[model samples]
Target: MKDAWIPYATRAVPRYTSYPTAADFTPETGVAAAMAWSAATRADEAISAYLHIPFCDKLCWYCGCATSVPNGYRRVAEYVGLLLKEVSLRGRAMGPHGGIGHLHFGGGSPNILNPNDFLELMDALQRHFGLRTGAEIAVELDPRTMKPGQVPTFARAGVNRVSLGVQTLAEDVQHAINRIQPRDMVVALIEDLRGAGIDAVNMDLMYGLPYQTTQHVVEAARFAAEMGAARVSVFGYAHVPWFAKHQRAIDENALAGLHERFTQARVAAMTLEGAGYVAIGLDHYARADDTLAIAAREGRLHRNFQGYTDDPCETLIGMGATAISQFREGFSQNLKDRKAWGEAVTAGHLPAERGIALTPDDRLRARALETLMCRLEVDAAEICAEMDVPDDRLDGALDAARELERVGLCHVSGTVVTVPEEARIMLRTVAQCFDARSPAAAPQRHAKAV
Candidate 1:
């Protein structure tokens, strides 16, 4: 019904979930910076935590997450052991923080670990940082690999939310992506999680996969609402075979074109918003009463490694291989190699391998990008005035906005830039206007924005 609005929203750009996106992270900045930032968390300040479980039971062709298929439980178990050790190591480095207000488990599939291992992991985390009284503990699950008793493991670990990766319910599409699961199976898993007291369920849906169409995307959106998903994230499939090797398995010829991808995303937005879900950012939607909805309505929504979130804690301590931690001053990322990470932790050193220290310019651009991403508008003059930045310093970004405005994607007043409501899908392109990285450096670096 809203087909006329599709053509204007498909431009590709960085999600701006972070300024100087992950593509900008390099080896020049290392563990020392991360440790210092972690140690800097005031004893009375609560922090957010993220743990990466990079092992998956099966590899989906469309997945771009940092994960690999472990041949057996031994590899995963080994990773878990190292994760726990890093947990303790980072805990020591953090000294005494107030407590963790938000704890998130993400990856290839967090549910792949055995129930007991999962519980012990949570216990180890609590012992280290100490969890806040009403903190939010969230995990991303692969319903296809979920075990019978794992739901209880999540509930017992005090997980208040579970995000199930149900990319699509169409059998053929699932088969094409190598992540098949019947619709009934997903519904059952939702019911099971709810019965186990994990009432907050977020379902991940996608379009532009091999053989996907706007019709399929709409169908999936309606089904998600029918299943009572509190939140649904509709992501346009980003095809980057050279980067994500498994993606090569996806037939490029069958993948939807950029315009079609745009329609699919728009269809999802229209369907979910029609179903009473509030669109929170470029890709996430939540029910009216959801915390994300509250965050958006109150202008408290935040963008993070996990995309749109409600967590306001400034320090984000990341654990496990290749995990990235954020602090007020900078970011630190753990080594991607399991053996190397474990060895570093065993040696009583943080396993961080690379990072970036945020410069004042980086911070300013970051705030500007976040404002545009979350609120769809930015008062450049006002923000610069508040930050004591010279107005002329943003001339380059203004020039970029002029180019976008010529195309009718955004409007620029004397000191403000506002992305039109219908052009929100192109918000990333607008956000990229402030990126300080060279074009050659970032173009080859990230997935297409569509």
Candidate 2:
């Protein structure tokens, strides 16, 4: 990595999974806004739903997800009941949408739910939201903690996609991260999921972890390819112990330095590409025949809270503690505290704790940012025209891009801004130029751009 790029790589920027990112959410625009937005959905449009399961059998030290070890099943069962009630409440609040076109189960670990409870939750989702025919049901799994019958149960429940948390294959790296699943364990689980007819497996790999090397990253990526993973996401470990408490367990001194982290990311990319996977976006690689790759090729790809997706629904309803929902009006998040979330649902209220209402400017900037992040380039004039805003409305952002251009981070050709292939890893930084809500310098609040 060039020394000139170090400053940009170390800067923090919103991932732009959503414009006016979660940092802009507040209590002033909470449940009432979420309800209004839900009620305003077009009846003819299909919607998507996300159910979060915030419990894990064991907490991994490096994990940043909102999850805890519920030593007993009691808390898990209670949460599931509350989640179902919340789902019903949200269903009644929504406009007469066509149906749920995509249903995603994410978590600390969605597989934490008892097999029967998981089934019941699925039934409730279908009953209340009307799961559209051929809807894709996707779940994120922790292969280390997945219960014996869970894979078969998921298959029986019509789950078409399963994402496994296989962060690394190196035993030492796994030990450093406090997640010690062997490569063979993940391989066996992949086989089990495929044998049960759920073949769309996505693997999550990590680089820049405590004591991780470029070779470790390469080996992990190769393992994903060998396991026939449809998609592989190589994420750089964000050491934010102050934010994610459990992350404090990680020894900061053992972590890869900035340049090492950058190299690891590049090595992972090369390894996945060498294994016949097409790079979809900054961090995701998909098999040449995978839907995600196809989506990217055709410009139908989308970035959401779940990272990258092919789902094109205009509305996304999120349920469970700390889950975030996206609507045309704005974004809403369920209460992060379990008790508060449960109480709200029990009281027949949407659990939205904080959110942001989108302004016309917010929408315009959001589209430009998404275009740049997803496509690695954006025609500023074209985006402004599509949003029905005057081209000059984005003059400030274009000016910001000019600075990046001078640094060789991106190119600004009139109203078009493009990140060169060499600067793809810094794509978030380029996208940040258009983020009006982000402060000029707020590195403490977000992960490094690299």
Candidate 3:
């Protein structure tokens, strides 16, 4: 690790997945605002939708997502009913938008749903949302809990892409994080998924976990390569136990230090790039022929709640408890309380609890941030021209990048700023320069930059 980069690596920053980050959302803008945004969608436009399944059969101690083990399928079934209601409620609320072009099912392990319920949910999404033919439907999976027949059920339900959470193959490391699916378990699942024709498989891997090492990250990357995974997401485990209380279960002493974490991340990138996987901004790697790689090569990669993606829909509808919907006019998130969310949906109202409406300035900063995060470089003047604003609109951001330049995290030349390849792991720290809402969030509100 570069000694000069050490001090900056520990700085807390937003992931720039959405900016103004979810940190800036407020009660002042609630479901009413969400309805206004969704209600204005034009019929000619394509949109995306995300369904959040906030339940897992067993919780992974290192997980920072909003999820809990439901103890039994009864709770999950009830949630699915609520989700189905929400699907129709929000779908009918839209103004004949040109159907869902892309759909994502994220979780606490979307695979935890009973196969029948899963199919039933998909059917509702299709019936209410007019799911565009050939839409890219994706789901996040937890292999350990994946049922015997989910692959076929998912395929028949139009799931073309599936992401498996395969954090690590090291037994001791797995035990440390309290998620232990053996290597062969993942292999068998992959084979089953491919055999069922769901070949657009993505794998999620992580570094900086308890007892994790550089070689452990390499082993996982190599495993993804050997399995012909379409894309691999290598994340540096953000150990924010305060935010993710269950993370407190992780052994702090067993976690990798800043320098070691940096090394592990670098080695993982090296392994993936060497194995013919194209690095997709920040922590993702995609095969040369994968759509994500194609998007990156053509400068079309987009970052969203799911991280780097090729999905380019401007509006994304989010459903279920704690789900967040993104619109050009603003963003809204559903209530985190399942009971409250269900009650609201049952009452025929959008369950959005809080969110932020984007201002003109917010939109500009977000565009600038997305450009830098996706391309690793941004020209302030170029973005201003695209937004039809004065070139100086982002002058303050350029000045901020100059400070980061002094620290070796980024370079600011003229009106353009670029993160050096070696400093890419700290990309969020660089992107934070364009965030006007950073002052609204404390350091503890986000994870470490590295």
- Quote each prediction's TM-score: 0.96, 0.98, 0.98
Candidate with more favorable, higher lDDT: 2 or 3: 3
**lDDT by candidate, in order shown:** 0.85, 0.90, 0.90
Count of clashing residue pairs in every prediction: 2, 0, 0
Per residue, candidate 1 scores C-alpha lDDT tens digits across 1-450 of 134434333334576767777777889889878877878888888999999999898899999989999999999988888788888988988956889999999997999999989998889988988999999999999988888788887888899999989888887998999988999888999889889999999999999999988888999999999887888998888888888988999999999877787788899999999999998868899999999999999999889888998888889998988888989988888898878988998888899998888999998888888888888888887778778989777777878888778877789998788988777777787777778873323454666666
What's the C-alpha lDDT at position 11 in model 1?
34
Tens-digit per-residue lDDT, 129-243, candidate 2: 8888999999999988888799889999999999999998889988988899987888888889889999999999999889888888888888888888999998888888889
Best model per lDDT: 3
lDDT of 3: 0.90
The all-Cα superposition gives candidate 2 an RMSD in Å to the true structure of 1.0
**Backbone clash total, candidate 3:** 0
TM-score of 2: 0.98
Off by over 4 Å in 1: 1-12, 438-441
lDDT of 1: 0.85
lDDT (0-100) at residue 343 of candidate 1?
Answer: 94
lDDT tens per residue, model 3, 1-450: 678777677778888899888888999999789989989998889899999999998889989998999978999999999899999999888977889899999988899999999999888988898888889999999999988778899988989999999999999999998999999999999989999989999999999999998889989989999999999998889998878999999989998899899999999899989999998888899999999999999989999988998888889999999899999888899999889999999999999999998898998998899999999999999999999899999999998899989978898899999999998898988888898879324779888888
* lDDT-best of 1 and 2: 2
Cα deviation of 413 in candidate 1 (Å)? 1.6
Model 3 spans with C-alpha error above 4 angstroms: 439-441
